[model samples]
Target: MATIRIGLDRLPPAARAAVEAHTGPLLTVEETAEGFNSEIAARVTSATGTWHIKGLRADHPRAWTQRREAAIAPFLTGLGPALRWREEVAGWDLLGFDVLNGRHADYAPGSADLPEVASLLCRLGETPCPSIELRHAEQRLEHYVVRPDLRFFAGPHLLHTDLNNANVLVGDHAAEGDRARLVDWAWATRGAAWLDAGYWVIWLIAAGHTPVSAERWAAEIPSWHTAPAEGITAFAAANANVWSEISTADPDPWTLRLADAASAWYAHRRTG
Candidate 1:
């Protein structure tokens, strides 16, 4: 479910003051509309520097997501934006991140951004999972996947399960090694390395690729080969079930689209 958004000025005086302490006096505040997780998401600038700030009320149900992102940020140096500061004051938990000057990835077929995204995921595949408290993929999918199939989703690799195109930012330098960076690590998980590729297949389908074509792109990531055919099929069905529930609870267009995409992918894999 999407959190209700509010502007930076709506923050409590103490909360706003605490933020200004890190970033001098605020000169401009631009609220971003790309993400659904944070109630407060905006780019703020001061004499010192510019940063993207995301926050939630300390008592909000999803406040732990802020902690999770802060805990995982240090381990994601090249793969994600750096976390510059964190503040918990006046009933809010806030995090400040270095702003990335990039655009959301274009997932449509034939877009130049595809290869860059593949490169980013390839780099992520090699990163070792940090020894921090993290969600386990098999546990997350346990209710949707059969018990026996759970083993297929277990692994030591750090996985960013959410593959929404908007979460990826493609920078100007295409030739550079780390030209793309992922954002929104709130759902970061410990799972089978290949599972992230599996999740990407769904978003690619939602972005207009057929299941066959999406799997072809997933093959570009080396770890995609590590997944067994049956495991892939099982993962597809599990996501189909997951999206069904999500769309039922919140029938937003994007959720419905993903639900349909997951069903299409599951059908393709089941019939093969």
Candidate 2:
């Protein structure tokens, strides 16, 4: 479920003061609506520089997510937006990230951004999983997947399991390698190297590709080959179940789309 978004102006005076201490005078504040989790999401500019800020109240139920992102940010150099600073004051926990000059990746068929996304995933595969506390992929899907199939998800790999297109930013600047960068690390997991590729398959299907076509795109990531056929099948089925639950509870159009996509992939995996 989406959190009720609040503008920077609504922050307590102490919290606002703390943010200004880092940003200098706030020249502009553009509240963004792309993400679902953070109550405070916006881009701010000052005499110094620009930053994308996200925050939640210290007492919020999801406050831990801010800490998770902060903890995981250091190891994500070259893969995600750099975390510039973090503040906890006046009951709010906030993170400021270097602003990237880019747009959300388009997942539609034949989009040029596809190759860039694949390249990003390739780079991510080479990053070693940091020994920080993180969730295991199998444990997350334990309720939806057959217990015996959990072995397929066990591996010492850093996995950005959320493959939502909104989480990917692609810059056309060739000097910057034209790579798609990932954001939103609150749900980062430790899992089999291949699992992130599998996650992308569902998003591809949601973007209008047939299940076979989606799997073909997944193959672009080298780690996809490490996944056993049966394991992929199990993962597909489990995701179908997960999305079913998600859509049933929220019933949002995007959730329904992903649910349909997951089902389509599971059906294809079963018969193929």
Candidate 3:
């Protein structure tokens, strides 16, 4: 099967109109292939200065995007260079951020950097945000996770859920110890924190790791699982969902163990 590609011209006319309105004449439009959802990266001169435009398709209700951007924008602004402005028009969410010199997916994680990434996950998971209604988690688990029709796991928590290697961007001239920036917040959600950590850990393991690498990841799992029982259970279920889809090997051991653990944890939490 040919892989589906997201391109700039794929934007609906209404969405394009919105982008043109904010970004004057577009000097160039580059389709960014870094996200699960269809996204476009455009370079255009505006009244202020040159800007990077990220346009996202509205998969859910329009209000959801507005609410989500509003909820997380303040938190993400100073943590790293983030979207400076956002507008929803037609069936898309258009955002503008300063044009930073970098490319996504270039950061290669070393054994030493694994802990730092884990620590960053802890920071993101621990940070609190206003509770938003997460009706999608239940629907995702039911339709996608349990059914095994979809390979991706949709877990609970306000997770930057799609934090794979590709989503990370670093300067081309970045030194050895410079911090990397994270983009792509389309999959952000509220649920289990460990799900995000587990997702990365599992990906690292799948990317062909040595015994030492495996041991390091194994040791870090507990820290990711530090959330309360309910949160942990939700994360475990999310992990199982993703594993069922993308794992090359039979997921009997991991899936069964995770499912049992999640069930037991939830039951215990309910009783307590």
Candidate 4:
């Protein structure tokens, strides 16, 4: 389904008033073209400072997703943007994130930012996931993989299962610790340390890496090097199935393209 975008003006009067009260008279509201969960996503600047406000109608199917992001924010170290505030503005739920100084990381093969992302993934693997009712990696792909092994995917590590290039931000050149910033924690989960690296493998291929090259990049992470072969295969197969289902449901160009990429990676895992 196409994303439904909501401008600032579309917010309920009371909600708008509530936001302005803290923001001190909004100067500019720029809609950001990213993510599917939120109906309202804008870079807003006030007389005081700038913030990225992401919101969804409280009754929307994905309304609960924002709550997950909000809950997970405090636990993330370098893995995600800081959640500055959260509010229920009228009938809509909203979250304000501290706007960072960076551009979306480029994921094309050999991009300099790849190493930073890999290092950040290691940091995420080290962070203990907060106790929340998170979906297990094994449970997430249950219907797709045959005779799923619960032991393979279950772990205490925090996993940002979606690591698309757009969700990663390359810190400004002048910033200390030019670490890549992960964002969009809506799909955050508790799983094996290597699970998130598997997710990134699919994206690396989609971003133009050959199967060998993608695997090489993923190997940079210590957890990924220690990943069980069976678990890796199961995760790859499951990811392939999920993308295939998504392509079948939508048949959009990008979905189909990524489904093919996942299939290719799965094939490589099996045949090589």
In terms of lDDT, which candidate is strongest?
1
Per-residue alpha-carbon lDDT of candidate 4 for residues 1-272, written as tens digits (9 for 90 to 100):
64598788999999898788778899999999888778999999988999999999899988878889989999886667788888896998889899877888888986888888888887787788899868777777778888656668888888888888889888865444446888888888888888888888999999889888998888988899778888888888888999999999999888887898899999999999
lDDT of 3 by residue, 95-119 (tens): 7767666655421336445554555
- lDDT of each prediction vs. the true structure? 0.95, 0.93, 0.53, 0.85
Q: What's each prediction's TM-score?
A: 0.98, 0.98, 0.62, 0.96
Give each model's clash number: 0, 0, 8, 0
Q: Mind sharing the TM-score for model 4?
A: 0.96
Q: Write the per-residue lDDT of candidate 1 for residues 1-272, one digit (tens) a residue.
A: 89999999999999999999999999999999988889899999988899999999999999989999999999997899999999999999999999998999999998888988898999999999999999999999999988999999999999999999999999996566567899999999999999999999999999999999999999999999999999999999999999999999999999999999999999999996
Misplaced by over 4 Å in model 4 are 173-177
Q: Order of candidates by lDDT, top first?
A: 1, 2, 4, 3
Better of 2 and 3 by TM-score: 2
In candidate 2, what residue range of length 10 has the lowest lDDT sum? Answer: 171-180
Indicate the residue-level lDDT of 138 in model 4.
Answer: 73
Evaluated against the true structure, the overall lDDT of model 2 is: 0.93
What is the Cα-based lDDT of residue 11 in candidate 1?
97
Supply the TM-score for candidate 2: 0.98
Error of 3 at 133 (Å): 3.6
* Deviation (Å) of 39 in candidate 3: 5.1
